[model samples]
Target: MKKVKRTTIYDIAEKLGITASSVSRALNNSNQVNEKTKELIIKTADELNYKRNTLASNLRKGQSKTIGVVIPRINQNFFSNVIAGIEEVTYQKGYSLIICQSDEDHDKEIQCVNTLINQHVDCIVISVSADGNDYQHLQNVLDHGIQLIQVDRVAEELETLKVINDNVQASYEAVSHLIEGGYKRIALLEGPQNLSIFKQRKEGYLKAFKAYNVPVIEELIVENAWTKELGAEGTRKLLSLPHPPDAIFASTSDFSALGVLDVANAMGIKVPSQLGICGYANESFSEITSPSITTIDQFSVYMGNTVANLFFQEIGNNDTITKPKIISIKPELIIRGSTKRNG
Candidate 1:
């Protein structure tokens, strides 16, 4: 099959008996061009199906009007909502977005960043995956002179515009909530400690214990139990101990908390009576659980909007927003039946 050749500005200009420069200026809506002539040129260009080459235009302008976003998993609700928020703000500014997922692999994350760089994206937004450990890939982004924004799960060492929740403060509040409800022995279903988010959450739990004068039990804490299966396994191990925890904080996510709730039910432990459970991320299923789990609402969508607007503000104002700026959004704890111990 023969390929259809795309029409160009030169073709339109020849057909209209005008210079290619005039056609180009008209297509770009330049004010220097006469309104009537510009309209005529545009009409002729449209008739000829002249489509401007964005790459050539961007090269001439010295920057692409495209932003690349990298996420661990695009299918997750939180990340998808964040992407939606980013699109809402970026599309209105006549910018394009390119999305890619790392699938929780460090190598893939590195590859994704390199691909974005090759594409000449003006900015790159990312939330590092759970398995990512190296920083060279991230450093390469900054070294290339492109704007980089890190959101949610981020690299702690890199100094960039970071839109993140107040993980420590929020976790402290969640732990304190359980204490106020008279749950003394609390078990933590912790995530990978390498991530700053999980470490901060652990800090909050410790701080709350110190504040309330409750003893922190090492035996009650489980490390690297981030998924539902891990949560369930950790819960089983903890409950089988001589003295089981009266409450569990699924700091990894709500899905982990759901695992705790299921295990507790199977063991005939009454929720909010014999066992209290809390989770993170405010996942939709948290509300629909048999006994709704108390969780932290990270305001993922709002965070995305904040990130997109931050890029625009820095780029539009030409300000020196140097020194790896960090913006922390406070997260709210949603109290539900799972953590309500008494009337």
Candidate 2:
């Protein structure tokens, strides 16, 4: 048996008794070609399984019809949902996606950006890693004449299309919810300060304290306690203090809140009775935890769809709408058992 060679325009043109140039022009919807010829060419091309070499066609057209997406971790629930949303839109627009994960490493993130650039992707969407501070990699994407879109964990310095949640407002609302539930002396577990998301959350926590006329205690604020282990470590320290906090806000993520729950449970401290807990990024597990953790829903899937649409709007429309755009999605606070006082 002979191996089948990939179908080409020449094959289709030959079958239709036409020149290859005619087939090419028709396939490209050139004004020089008649509409009937274009329809016949497309129909025959489809029947012959003549898959146009997207790379070569894109090169000729000067548009790849492909987009690159970079995230901290692909396995994370939030990032995964965002990717799904991006794919939903890009697929509809006949575009392809190349996804890369940075694993929270700045060097790896830089390499991922370079790889995407090398691939000549039309657009590069990114959610910066925790270790990211130097944004030369993100800047390089823009310098390469590629559309740069930052979503979720974005860098503030770069003027690009940014689709993000209202982190400060969401955090403030969550903290306020706890306060309304009679939680005072609320301790906070913060993420890495380098990322704007964490910094905004920290600011919200501080603002909530100031609004309530509660003195901000430096001792209760733990730095870089974004991980489960770090959250546990921070909880141990906070709970050990002679004036231990009555509540804890894991402003990092749900994983950190899980850590707080475990530590409190291990120490025989009843949730909502002794301590109230709140988390960010409403993970699925947050709802299932013994005392379901109250959290902020960032609408990860909706955020992703918004990011994809931003790119589609820019690339699909052949215009010079060059103004840098910023879109902030408001997040909702989900109340659960962990933060509720009355049974």
Candidate 3:
């Protein structure tokens, strides 16, 4: 491969017929260089397409000025919004982000973490995959002296900086709303049990039932039904049962609820009137659906900004070891045609 040489300050100095020291002082915005000379040097540097070596500069200061972000899926609405939010704050602070997708695979998640460690990033922000249970990779990051922060789907055991939604409370609210709206048999579409977020959601579902004195039906609970395909399969089986549920709470994501909607449409079952549905993650498509799916707003972008700001606040003060912090955001239940039964 051919390497195109990068334009450096020296190239600008040569082009502008000036000493390299003068060019360096001007680039650094130092008062040592006169205003007129600084202006001339900057213009010449811009003309030469000169780029400052941020990586080298940061290395000299013993910091990377870069953060490594590991997410389950970049294409997902929630994760994407969070990344955008993190970028919004990090960009203003002159920090660069290195993003990696785990694809919800444990081995791949490990690889992503290892790669980030090798890169020597100042900090790493992660949302563990559904299949991730062991977090030696995360421990290794901390051992390597890299600041580690967990967001959303995180490992509860690891004592680190964490930003997440109160899943149990959110799930409780969603189910409570359904029960209040007259849903007799509310089914649950669950994700991987190993993940703390999913477990908390399931706990919330059970808690709601207990609070209302509703009988728990073991058959109505579907495991590993976090995705649309699995959600659809689970719904197909549920609706086929003689004692089908009157409502379904897709506690994983909005996509799963969308799958429930699809299955209901194909089976000619009426929504809200016949089978009410609720989903987590307030995706854009949720509002556009025919009846509009009732879902939870996790404040994904805000969550991301919070995560980024936390990193800056703690890391800036050199206080990573002093405390283990957990920031929780309350999720909101959005009522839509899918869950609104009142005529």
Candidate 4:
């Protein structure tokens, strides 16, 4: 196929018998160009099918007006909702987004961040991957003088703008609710302890037990059970114990909670009567299950909006020594049939 050349400002200027600079200024809507000449240039450019070189133009302004986002999974409801919220705010500001998924791999997360840095993005927003233990790549982003915003999962050592949920309080409330339901022995399905969110959740669980004077059983707590299959496996192990728990809290996610419910059903264990279940992150399926799941609502979309707004607000400030700010949104506990044993 024969190549067709793209029309440029110079071509439009030649057609209008004017300088290329005039055409450039007119195309950019610069007031330096008079109305009459601007109209003529625009008309000629339209006739020539001229398209402005946005990349070149943005480079001159010292910014791409683009933000890069790195997330663990793009298809997950919570992350997708967060992306939608970011788009809602960024779109109105004439900024574009470059979204990349790490798929919960640390290496891929690093690659995504490096790619964003190479793109000269004005800012980078990220929810770190599960396997991430090193943050030198994230530090590289700051070394290049680009704005970095961490949301949800974050690297605690770095001092940057962060938006996160009050995981500890949310988990505390969930466990307290289970205890209040007269469930004496409760099991816990926990995520990777390397992540701060999971560690904080565990803290909440322990705190709840202390507050109620309930003895904490070490055997009932299962680690690395953030996935559905893992949760199910954990549940089976817990149920097989000589003294089984009456309640289970899947503090990792609703998917994990669903796994617990599935295993209980297969084992002929009735929920809220013989067993109780609670989950984190109020996934869509949580409410539609046989017995609706008691879960925490993270307001993921609102968190995304807050992340973008924080970026914009910080970018506008001229102070170079701005201290890192952290904004924590409180998650709400939604009571449902899964844990409503008394009612």
Candidate 5:
């Protein structure tokens, strides 16, 4: 199939028998151009279906007036809400967004970042992929003088603007709640330790155990159980142990916790009484489950808004040298039936 050429000011100029500069001036509503010529140029532009090159225009002014956002997945509730929040602010500020999803692949994430960079976007906001161990692409954004903002999952070594949840504290609260609820022999389904967020969450879980004087059982912790399928697999193994845990914490996400619940129900294990469950990231389905899962509300939408606001605030500053800023939002632990044994 042949590509259709986009109509430009030059095409309008050629059709109207006028200079391209005059056509450009008229299209931009310049006062120098007479009303008659402007009217004619606009009419011709409409006929030709001419669209203004906003990116080129903004680039001439040393900006693109556009932001690029990269996420692991587009369908996740938390990510979609965050995108909505970002769009809300960016639209109001007359800025557009170019969204890309890495599908949790490290290579795809790098490609997305490079594409955004080549587009000459003014800012790049990213929640790094799970499998990404190298961050040269992120550093390249900074090298190219593009404003970079890391949200949710991030590489801690880079001194860039970041908006994140207090994962450690949130995890601590979740685990502490389980301990207080008389659920001993608790198990943890943890995500990949390569990411700082997951590492922080593990730290919090350990802290809670220390606070309560609960002996940490190394055998009860499952690694890389961040997804629903992995969570279910881990749950099966845990339940099959000689001394199965009475409670399980899916520290990765609500989806993982849902997996735990599914496995428990299948085995006829009663929630809260025989097996308690807790999850991170208060996904919408968490509240609607038969036995509503106890989870942490990350305030994902608010986090997105905060990231945009931070970009605007930092860009407005005229300082030659700026220190990296980190904003941590405290997540709320919502207690539900999944862990409410006494209730």
Candidate 6:
């Protein structure tokens, strides 16, 4: 097959009987070229299907005008919403984004960062995977003089720009709501403790019980119950105990809470009456579930918008000086049928 040649400024210049330098200035909208000549050059360039090489153009300005985003899963509602939010602002700022999914693998996360660095992306926004123990990949980004931002799940040890949800407070509110609804025995389906967010959520659960003077049942608290299958298994085990919990806080995700609800149905237990369910992330299906689940709304899209806007505000001005910044968004409790035992 014959290769189609890309249209360049030289081609436009040759068609117009002018030097390539004049065409370059006209395309760049530099004041050195007159308006009439610029108009003619643009028109001819458009007719020739000319497209500016953004990679080369950004190199000249010492910027890529591009951002790299790394998330665990693109199909998940929370991460996808965040990406949409980032794109909304980046699009208007004349920037582009290169997105990657680590699939919750540490090695893949490192590879994604290295790829972004090699591409010379101006900034990198990441939500570390569950296995992201060593943060040398992030340090490498800083060493290369690239801006780094962490969202959702961040490494607290690293000082960088971060936009995250207040997991502790949110979990506190969710558990507190269950307690207020007159639940004495509340079980917690927790995530991996290594991740800061899960640890904070566990802290919040414990704090709520402490505040209420309620003794925590050690058997009720399950570890690594982050997935639907695990949540179902945990629920079965908890419900089978001699002194079973009347409420469960699936603090890991709505998906886990969903598993609890499914198992409860199969076991002939009623939600909010026999057992209340509260989940995190307030996934869309939470509202549609029978006896819709009570959950915490993380404002995922707003979090994403905040990340993008923060980058533009801090770095878009071309200021060399920058300081470590942290923005924490407060999540709200959406009390639905699953946890409304009293009302």
Per-model TM-score on C-alpha atoms: 0.90, 0.88, 0.90, 0.95, 0.96, 0.93
Best by lDDT: 5
Tens digit of per-residue lDDT, candidate 3, span 109-135: 999999998888999999999885899
Predicted model with the maximum TM-score: 5
- The pairs that clash in candidate 4 are none
TM-score of 4: 0.95
Give lDDT per model, in order.
0.91, 0.91, 0.93, 0.93, 0.95, 0.93
Worst 10 residues of 1 by lDDT: 316-325
RMSD of 5: 1.6
RMSD per candidate (Å) reads 2.5, 3.1, 2.8, 1.8, 1.6, 2.1
Candidate 6: TM-score? 0.93
Structure candidate 2, residue pairs in collision: none
Against the true structure, candidate 4 has what lDDT? Answer: 0.93
Best-to-worst ranking by TM-score: 5, 4, 6, 1, 3, 2
Q: After superposition, which runs of candidate 1 have C-alpha atoms over 4 Å from their true positions?
A: 1-5, 10-26, 29-41, 319-321
Number of clashing pairs per prediction, in order? 1, 0, 0, 0, 0, 0
Worst 10 residues of 4 by lDDT: 47-56
TM-score of 5: 0.96
- Tens digit of lDDT per residue, candidate 1, span 30-126? 9989999998898887787888899789868998899999998887778888998999899999889999999989899999999999999999999
Question: Candidate 6 residues 154-220, lDDT tens each?
Answer: 9889899999999999998888888888999999999998899999999999999999999989999
Error of 6 at 205 (Å): 0.2
User: Over the stretch 98-188, how does candidate 5's per-residue lDDT look in tens digits?
Assistant: 9999999999999999999999999999999998689999999999999999999999999999999999999999999999899989999
lDDT measured at residue 50 in model 4 versus the true structure, 0 to 100: 81
How displaced is residue 305 in candidate 4, in Å? 1.4
Q: After superposition, how far is residue 151 of candidate 2 from its true place, in Å?
A: 0.9
